[model samples]
Target: MHRLFKNALGLRKCRAFAHDESGALIIFTLYILMAMIMIGGLAVDIMMAEERRARIQFTIDGATLSAADLQQTLEACDIMEGQFRSAGFANVHVNHTRNGAQYESCGVAEPDADIAVDVASVEGIGYRRVEAEASIRVPTLFMHWVGIDYMDLPVSGAAEERITDIEISLVVDVSGSMGNPSTSGETKIFELRKAAKEFFTAVVKNDPDDDSAITSVSIVPYYHTVHVGEDLLDQLNANGGTVSVQNPITNPPGLTSVQSEQQFSSCIEFTPNDFKSTAITPSQKLTRKAHFAYGSSSTRFPNYLQFECQEDRFDTRYAANSRPHIMVHRTEKSQLDAHIDTLTASGNTAIDVGMKWGVALLDPAIQPAVKTLADDTTIPVPSRVNDRPANYWVPSVSANPQDETLKVIVLMTDGVNTTQYGQTTENQYPYINFKNSPAPVWRFKNWSTHEGKRHDRWSVNRNMEWYDQYLIYVPGNSWSNRWYRPGDPNTSWDDQWYSTSEIPWDGIAQMDWVDLLDDFHVDYMAEFFWDEAERYYHSYYGWSTREDPMEDKLKASMITQTNWWQANTNLSEICAAARAKGILIYAIGFEVNTGEGPMRDCATEGDAYYFDVSGREISTAFAAIANHINQLRLVQ
Candidate 1:
């Protein structure tokens, strides 16, 4: 009975203890402690992994950029490996889409795998794209506790950029004013030479083996005229057309007349409005003949001359293979540099014509003509983009953002607008063009004494003999007696110096003169009658402005001022159009008296595209342009 009672008591005590829950807190605390330790360990591992991934990403990013150079070779891979090793990474897998070793430069030839350079030609421009990928297996420390012995840290990077391949037309003003000395004691032309050479070096580096690199340039040096070498005109299909200038058959207005076909200054006359854009259609080619003025204006209508142009020298130059050949484009940088050596400063400024020609070469509508020329000649025209029309240009802006190509023009000038000259058949009487010695074309010195009075007696020489003698003196002895008639065809070569009765102009005379009265090629010549009336008015009256020249003789479209402001404004519009077409226009107004005008407006304002420089500043201007263009090119 006692044992049974004790057992029942023990059971009751056990039940009480179970119901009490006294040790429950301590047991739960111990279990919680164990759980906390496991959670803490996982958190520590995650933190360590994150920090390691961050470090790997930084290393990979640096590696990618370093290895992305198109100029680098396959040895860049070894460099990358070294970098990885230095960064505490081993057995790193470095891979690329092209091999830099095969091509000294990305475009030295075509690209190969193991190289990072490859940017598809956007529109017609070449670009460089690089992609670098790197991966490393990192041995895990803390995470390995969870059955994870290793971790993959992969990082990749890429760079895309627009790089080089430019077709530039450097339209420089080889105008007479460029020969003037600057404050720095250097001639504008001399400064330009130094600047231009540096500019060439800056923009087009020494990359001889890059066949795929299509960077090219056209040196369009202009004065009162741009001799569109017949090769160029013919190639560009600017030939085969006829311009009817004043008939050379007669000078001044003739009561009885004839209209004959004669080519004008290869500088076809285009209205100021014509230059609003670069889309010059086929119909707008050079087809008008340019006319020059007679010093004096008689109610009977003064005689005029055809502006001397390049048509006559076309056949000769093509055969001689001489330099300063009409270069509409040149593929190699060396070719451009060589051509630049042939520049000479002479004649008046013709920015309108120069800029127009520059724009024409970039026009897509003219591509067909260019292709025709290329096919016929040895020129390797840029025809990769458009095989038929030969599209090598890209629009400035379009619905498609990919349309991109660098078409540039660097136009430099040292003077403001001035009158252009032309020549006339004759005076019905002979007139002195100018002295053979170097002097202004508009040089019409009114000597104090015309009639010697045989001296003191102011008398006019009635002898028409001098006029007769002047007409007879041709440049070459071969063409001495054989003189060309103004409006008459080759059949009309006049050999009539013996008949001096027709000789007329009273009072003045010039000594060494090769009367280009009816000729176009100016290998040899005298002063011209261009802007004669304006100059006469200036000398007779006083210096004048474009606003209102004395009596409004109409030197150029009747708008006589120092500059052709209207034309210049038109040029501005053309520049804006070029810019809109994705063509970069850089302008240097070297020693411009007006301090502003067409050249200033031709380039973007305040963007280093327009430089109104002086003396040596020209070099800085050109270098800046080169650098700007270089920066604009495709690259990573």
Candidate 2:
């Protein structure tokens, strides 16, 4: 019975052992723990790879940015490589392609990973665009066991510095102050030339690889007034004056025939109303300013260089290339540079006039005149920029952004506005008897010892015998009966003569008032005529303002005077008008007083737009502005 019981127990035990699951549960736990470990490993590897990829992406972002900078002087790909080196990525390999060129790899033998960089740069007259793309192969750590080897981190960026379709009005002051030396011991004009030329080179870079240009610049050199060239006067249809003289000093003189005189001065007399707005109306009839100068006769007689109209100095009417006149939209660097070199400093400051012309060039109202000038050969305007001086940007209006223009004005001045002079509409001055038309002069010096006799008697008479000789006309009622006509008056010279016929002043060739004032100084002409009348006929004629003939003439000629205060008001108005139209203004006060406010108020509301520099700092200021325009910014 024990044996049988034992056998049953053993059988039961075997069955129990077969149903027990503790050891099997331990084995299953082992398998699950193994799988969990593998998964954990994978997660760790993926997270590490992601971190590495983020690092690579960060590096690439910096690299592409530096590479795409227009100011970056190094090769695009080279710049990218340097950026990587700077970022402590010396081991990472770089493969770069620029402008469709073949891919080139940096010498990184057996690098852990590779970064591919592609760059494309396009340069133009007023714009530069750079696009860069980068991708890094991040070798996976644990993921490779599962057939995943690497992850790609791609970063792309683009940068652009574009002032596309830009119109710039460079209103530079050529006032006499510009001739003074700056703190740097160089003439202000000399320094200005270098600075302005560099400014052009920076903004209007003519890339040798690209012939396209969308930038145009108009040069308006101003002094007391803006001198519109001869062509501009004709375009404006500004009319000149005519002078006529009747039989003068006669009993009830008769009116003589009138003759039209050419407009010698190219300056316009803008009324007080003209400064309230920025438009230079093409259809409006502009009165041509009379040519005259005001100063003492001693300092301004023969030279006549200080005339209100600078036509005598520049002679732009005769010389097409003469400067101090407006030079319309120019593109060529050579042409612009040459024009700047010709700038001469003379005349008082008239900041308002300068700003007026500067703003006018950018105004759309002046398009007709600009178009006409663009077709003209002397203007140096390129055909490609024929549609320049584009309309001001209005964001509310619907249009493509690329078509919008950026108008910039760089107004530079050294001094505040001074007294400006203009002429009257009426011919209130005396007619000048030119030297070409000689009048008869009779002189009778009586030596009391001898009988009453006339000496040194001379006049202008026609003589066929001796080319041309002076002859005195002695009328029948004179002390000596001498009928002198078409012959020399020397036949009656006996060192003794008497006063005879009154000088025939009616036969003299009368000069037009405009022509006379332009050719001769006001005080000089006044003195000449007054002295002639007093010395010859013992009489006086013409308008007298101060009882002094010279002073009267000077006052009559300079009828219009724009004081410094009025000019400042006009400048401020024009500047505000320009800014309201979204036109950018950059004003420079070179070697000017600190208290000056008009120039400061004219600039766009920022220090970057206004430069009150002196000496060589002017160049630094100009360079800053140029750089601001060419400053790089990420587009994407």
Candidate 3:
């Protein structure tokens, strides 16, 4: 009975143990926890791998960009390695163009593809697609029991950059206003000088990497007029042959025009619709001639180029002074620096001429000085792979259509639009004192009116001293006034009998060229008729101001004011054209007391285009523009 009972108990116990729920739930829970731990470890590893990938990619991008810089003298490989190591990356194998054109690296990335956009260009301009692959083994904390010792993470990254070629035309205002004090208490011109020098230094960096491209700079200095070089002046039709400009008179055969027998310095003159355009498109639409009817730089100018009578100047000033012209065509670092120092301030502010020349210089159609210095090492142009305008600005990379060249014109001014002097006539001669109190005594208002008349018809109203006194041969009247000043308008002139004592009565008949030449009469005309009629004796000869009428003629008679306000249209059009053609225009206005409205309109689009005010800000503006331009010179 006891054996039977013990067997039943043990069978029941075995059945209970087989169906037990408590311990089974505990075992199942333990197994699930172990699996969850393994999965969590994998998730941690993946998260770490993703973080590593981002970090490594950032490092690679930095390395690639730095290595592609034109100013970067360090090797690309070394740069990449250094960057990766700094980013806490170990055992990284980097490779690509070394000691060569590109800044590419990576042991397993495509080496030849997108090596660099233009690494040899200034400041890493183009896209240098850099790729980097990282292999990292993460030690697992919980997966070791499953025979997996570590997690293999492969992190790869790639990146690209682009920089274009830059061409800059720096136009500054050398007008009188630039000499004024600025906000920083310095001369605006001086600030401009400092700014310009800084700009040159910042842009024209002699980088070995920028071998394929260059940053070209040209300067255009201006005042009331921008004087072009002789090359452009020689190209004019007036300079060619048989030059004739319209005159005021119609008599004396060919007396109705001024002829250019002598070459003169080129001046900004008429264009389409009697306005100056920045587009100096060397076409024959409008004649490109300088205002050379008057050549004397002094206040007195011979009103006519060559006519019946020309005045002899007394104490001229500009006989030896070279006609002023701009100093920059091609910009070398040293030469640019020198030019910045030599800029002086003295002249009316003519922004129109300045802007015209500034934009005109950049136009490929016209660049004589630039062409001359394109081959010089001091001022290099763009890339010279093709024969087009040798060493001129062009795209660094030919294959990439997106790669374009950049051209810039920095136009700066300190004053408002003042009137420009214009000479619309030729025979504006006033050989006799224009408005002297004794003028018009002879009644010869126009020289051409007496072209074919007789001497008796012309009359002199006075007589005077004989030493420095003037004598006139009125056609058949003869050189000696021995006919007696009969019926004089002022009776005192007739009573001046002592004046006849020194008169050359006998020498009059001996005069051979006495066909009554008006030219000879004008050269020795007795001016100041009122005063001379009262004078009797004076031993030493003296020059009377009335004898030379050149000063009066040039003062207001020859120089006429033009509506320079019309120049705004030309200025805006030029800026628009340049901007349309991918050219950048920066217009800076310093102490623009009149208004910066025109200057603001002249600048290109965006804040980068316009800078109004002076002092350190001028330099700041220049530096900003330069940085932008320099960036263009870089190939990524």
Candidate 4:
């Protein structure tokens, strides 16, 4: 009976153990711990995969960027594979697509399709874009339990390096105000030189890599006008022919000297029609800027030697130096920097003329002239720029679109447009007829030798020392009453008073209008004749009744060629035309005192292109522009 009771208690204990809820909690906890371990393993696997992907993405980004640079000498696939190997992915293989064409390789001689890479190109307005894409597989460490053995990591990169050829025109202002001090206490031109040199180096320098594309720059420095240079002048249709004029006080009496319109100047006169378009037609006749000084200080009596054009001058007091001429299609950094260093400031501001020349240089119309310049042995244009001043880009019509070029103009100024004086193309002046020949007026060699009395009176007396006197002849009238010495010393001076038709005028010498103006003041020339008329015809009573009409005629010949309003309008039009032709324009108003409207409108519409800077800020502006331009030549 005791053994049977022990067996029943054991059975009861087993049943109680099977139905116990307290132990069930411990079992559930065990299962939860197992799940947590498996989850943690999966998380570790995912983290490892992500790290690999991040590394791969970085490698691809760097690889593609280096490959896409136009300066890179290696093939895109080769560059990418080398980068991958450097990143410790030696066994990886890639299927490469270059500009929509595909090739498979493992960075080895054999083809392997495990990984993928692509490089493509897209055309931009003024640049060509290169895109690179790549993808790699990262082997999984723990997620393989879920039937996933690897995770795919895809990476992409794009770069553009001004693949198309580029041409830049740097238009700079050298106005008198630029000589004044800037906010930085230095002259505007001084600051400009520093900024411009830095900019030139930034654009022309190729750091650690060489580019396949061509990039050329032109420097157009202007004040009242532009000096297109002697070589380029030969290509243009400038009407600067030589004219023969008699020299004053020549012993031979009528000795003629050849006078060239370009003797003192080398500038062209642009008509309103020329400004209507950006085209510089070689066949069209361009008038030469007159070689005369109309400025108040220069027009002072006995000081007409100061010509309006500063081309022939070699003085630094006038400009930085005498080298104020355009330099076109150059690629050498040192050459451009040296050119920028020579810039000086003088003359009035003619922003319109500067802009016109700046745009013209970029236009294809100037290509013919550029070619001639390139062929020249002295100061030859760079061979790299042989095909430049290239045709205006018409993307649709381009035979090989990759051959397109970008045109750019950088216009900088310190002042607003001022009055630009020019000689009129009118024939209203009577002096025009005598410009190439001797006038009908003869001057005494020693008129001032006698006291003021003999100078005012006209007498012919051998006994009274008849020697230096002036004689005048009206077209329909006879010679004026004046004393003249015989050609022979033995002959009497009184014998010449015989008749008006038989006057002995060989003893005196006369000069052409051009020579006369160069030798004496216009007022003096006009007054001498008037005083002679009073002495010869006794017309002093009515002389005051008539004003000095000759002076009015002389002054009227020089009119305001380009006024403020016309200049502004022309500037706007050319800027618009340049934009329409797909040329990029950048304008900077450096310490501008007057309105900035013209300059602002001349630049490209975006704020990135136009800068209104003062003093040392000009350097910042130039740097910004250089960065903005050079930025396009790098990966996007």
Candidate 5:
């Protein structure tokens, strides 16, 4: 019985061992499954965190870009908040300071709320690099079931805002080609106008203070020629009539109506006092051959000339308040509006002409007179008066001369220089002719003929004695048997000949020869008459008589006729000339190949002065320039 009990105990122990082994196997399987679940959950939470971080980062990046482009603080904040909301951020807040620091806040669980946007500047470098960082809490998906509630996510982004003083010239191509339909189905001119207006608004926003600190954009509208507004044209009378008047006169020769029925129908009434006269002979009877009629003439007259003598008439007929010159140089909102309204886009693109006019307008030498306001004693003033006194503020001119003001010219051209016309002061000499003879002249000593020559045939040696003989020839003598004399030629003399070949020809070729003379003749009398007529015409009308250098020469030498050229040259020279002057030149060449020779010369070395941009990237270019100007620290 003891042996059987021991065996039973052993069997029981064996059963127990088997049960323990099976339980161990089950525990191992459960542990393995649990580990797998944990790992899979963690992975899902990581992915969610990554996606949230990516979304936040993208939003921040876009916000930064938008802020960099913002000219106003409110706009920057609005854009940043809008971008955050669009990116699915739960709650977004943005606060930015103009020309200062910016702070951003968002309700991100994992990210730290104390995120800072740090801006760093490198001395001598124009741009400031901005970096932002934030930590946000990302809600877990499956991991939340396993005691894990959220994931901590870190995100960061960087951007650069460059500050540069920009000197830009908006050179628009107002050529005939601009009138063609653009890719947008609108005329290029219309598109340009729209784009320009947008650009102008942007510029105004950037430099809103009117302190002239940020930028000054000079709009240069060029077609075949540049149109200098009538106001600017009035100041450049330096060369007299060398520069043709912008517009010219037009009038019919005869009166359209007669009051008296008794007046002879065939005879036109002559009223000297009532009639206007040309500078030439007054009231000359019009010959049938003379192209004169009473009706409107077809000859296109220049705009300047058209109203030259009619200014008084226009003033009388049109109310002075409604006239174009009512607000000549005032900064009142309506001034520019009225001026722009009067601008009619007609005529060819004269870029050079327009540029010249632009230069003249900006010339310090020709700056408009600044009004001196009488000081107000009633109001208290600051003890330490600012350099820019309130009374010294002018409507058209800048107040502070020391501020880093921007001067820009926008030059656009659809084609190259085709036709160039200008009034020059240089004189061109006319051609003259002269003739010469090959034979030499001689003179003889005085001697009287031997009294009718009765028998005085003393032929002593025909050759040797002839040298000793004394004979004189009269002025009208023929050279049959005449001797050579000292003063008067004993030999026959022919009339001195003058030819056209001897004359020197200089000056511009006339556009129409018929306008100067009817028929070409070598006749001296006709030539003399034409010369007098030309002199008189120039003296009265102010036409150019100088020869222009070849276009190639002008291009090669960089002697540009454009306002930018003159301004650049003036700036360079002025900088070199004055020790106190700190002149900055910024050049931006749009859509042009960077490797072009002209483009390369347009910019200076180092950071702020040079930028080459694609044609479409004007906004970025302007931003860079604005940032540069804002960063300038006034040196003591």
Candidate 6:
């Protein structure tokens, strides 16, 4: 019985051990399942964080880019805020400061969630950067049974915007050719004017108000020369006038003899006292001839009559209007308008002169603005004589204090240099004369003293008949005279008497003279470009307000003017200088045939600033240039 009881106790202990082992196994299995759930939840949180990071990155990047293009700092901030919200980052908080670097953000989506982002170096870099962070509360799945409710998942990203500033210059052709009708039946000049005005308005409208903004524009108008009107005229007197008139044949008035008589009579009635009673001679009679023979094809009688009348009336009218009457040419509004109206195309082109004058006006060395009292007081003045002991010099009243702005020149020409006139030379003449020597004669008297002894008498006489002899005389000749006469010592009738005479006459002939040719003075060329640049710059900045006698702030670039039409070999140097000085040089080749020598030398490289436009396309080319300049400005 004792042995059996011991065996039973052993069996019971074994069963109890087995039961404890099973319970331990169950506990192990539960732990393993809980661990698996936790692992899965962590994986999901990681994925969510990564996806959020990507979304935030995309949103920040887009917003930063948009902000970078903004003209104002406030606008940039607004853009960032709006963009983040739109991207579903409603919980994101943004802080902007002018401390010149980095956009900072910090926020949480829930009590258990942590979210943070850093957009570093927002100002130190050329681009603007935005840092973003997103966080969410991730509830545990099976792990919830272990008393852990949720975990915080955070994602972060950064975005940046790239920015660049550009400078541009526009050169336009305003030559007479631009007035030609376009395919649209409007003058190229008209189209160009419209387009240019639009472009100017648009660019000015969109330009950034920030002082450190990136873009600026300049307009240059050139024909055979450019006309910058009053500003340049006031600064350098560089504005040139161009006069164009329709061909007589094309603009003839349709008037018959009766109509012509009527018109003439009416004109006579309105004529001033000085012009009244001018003789109407038959010389003014109109002959009936084929219009074609006169270089015309119009068959209308009125047209023919008008054509004839125009030819007769043009001279008188032109003479009266073109008389050099004005003295100290003024450049006021009325004057400029009148000058423009008076511009008649009748003189040789002088592109160099025009360009020169234009550049002079914009030369900072010549015309700078005067400083105001405020600026003068704020900025320290440099000592003029440092060698001397320091003393109060009444602050040498601020010379021109205008800002040193960019310079530009636009050069254009219709034709190359031609012959110049108004010069003088010397004149000379030659002549000749001859003289004759006297002859002697003897006579005997036979009579009277026959009674006394042989009487003898002697008489002498001479004739001067060689004075009219012909002799060819050459003034500059050294060789010989065609008609040379040798004088004789012995001659008729003289009683041992020597006869001699002086010849005072000499042949005279005119000498040939040579006059030096006048050099092709292209004064208009330089003046045109300089004036255009100055005028445009001034217009862009508004005119100067000081009364200081400084150089014109709107002068053309002298360096550019001197080299504008130089050889191609020097083009790179010329363009380089212009670019360095922040000057945009625009060149137009009008009716050019010299392989673009001048145009290429004058224009910027890559054809970005040069145009070789035909006469009819000049306006179009100018419009295109203005449009390009407009594009450089910020767009709202």
Model number with the top lDDT: 4
* Best of the two (3, 6) by TM-score: 3
Per residue, candidate 2 scores C-alpha lDDT tens digits across 1-636 of 999999999999999999987678888999899788779978887787677667655665665566555566766567666777786677544454455564454344344445555667665445556666766676766667668887766777776666566788999999888999999999999999999999999988655455344667889998888888776666665753444454432321222434332466677777767877878867877766666656534423344346666564445432432336787777778888998998998778888888888898898887777777778777555655556567888777736444378788999998889988876544343433321111232212222222232223432232123212212333322344332222222343222223325323344232335544554466654553333222222233334343455546445645668898898888888899998988889999899885468887889995658898999999999998888766766677
Task: Note the Cα lDDT for every prediction shown.
Answer: 0.51, 0.65, 0.51, 0.66, 0.34, 0.34
Worst 10 residues of 2 by lDDT: 435-444
Give TM per candidate. 0.54, 0.64, 0.57, 0.68, 0.35, 0.35
Q: What is the lDDT of residue 171 in candidate 1?
A: 89
- Model 3 per-residue lDDT tens digits across residues 1-636: 999999999999999988877767888999999899889987886687577667765776676667655446676567776776687665565655533455444344444432211112222344344444555566666667688787766655444344445567788888777888889998888999999999888877545455445555667777666666554444333243443333322211112222232233355555424333344544433222323222322212212232111112221322332233554443358877886787777656667667766666666655443444444454334333111112233446455433555567888888776756554343444332121111111222233443444433232332222221223222222234322222332344433221334434433221111111211222222222323432221111122344444233233443455455766665666676666655678888776766687788877774558887656888888888776665522222
Error of 2 at 481 (Å): 21
lDDT per residue as tens, model 1, 507-594: 3233222223233223112121222223322332233553553233322221122246655676777787777776778888887768
lDDT of model number 2 = 0.65
What stretches of model 4 exceed 4 Å from their correct place?
1-63, 71-94, 97-130, 134-157, 205-212, 240-263, 296-304, 313-323, 378-387, 399-402, 430-478, 482-553, 632-636
lDDT of 5 at 132: 45
- What C-alpha lDDT, on a 0 to 100 scale, does residue 436 get in candidate 3? 14
- Selected candidate, larger TM-score, 4 vs 5: 4
Query: Candidate 4's residue-wise lDDT over 1-636, tens digit each?
Result: 899999999999999988877868788999898788779978897788778777777777777667656556666678777887798877665555554665544254434655566656543334445676666676776677668888777777776655457788999998888889999998889999999988887777532234356678899998888877766777777645666553443422453653444334567778766676777867767666765555434323332344456554544333433446788888888888888887877778788888888888888887877887777677568655656688887878886434577688899998898878776654444344322445555655555565345321244422233323445443333443232222222343333322343444554566444445443344444443443243332232122323445444445644446888888887888888888888889999897767988888888985668898998999998888777766643344
Candidate 1 weakest ten by summed lDDT: 435-444
In candidate 1 the C-alpha lDDT for residue 22 amounts to: 72
Q: How many residue pairs clash in each candidate?
A: 29, 6, 15, 1, 55, 64
Residue pairs that clash (backbone atoms under 3 angstroms), model 4: 320-344
Cα-based lDDT at residue 229, candidate 1: 59
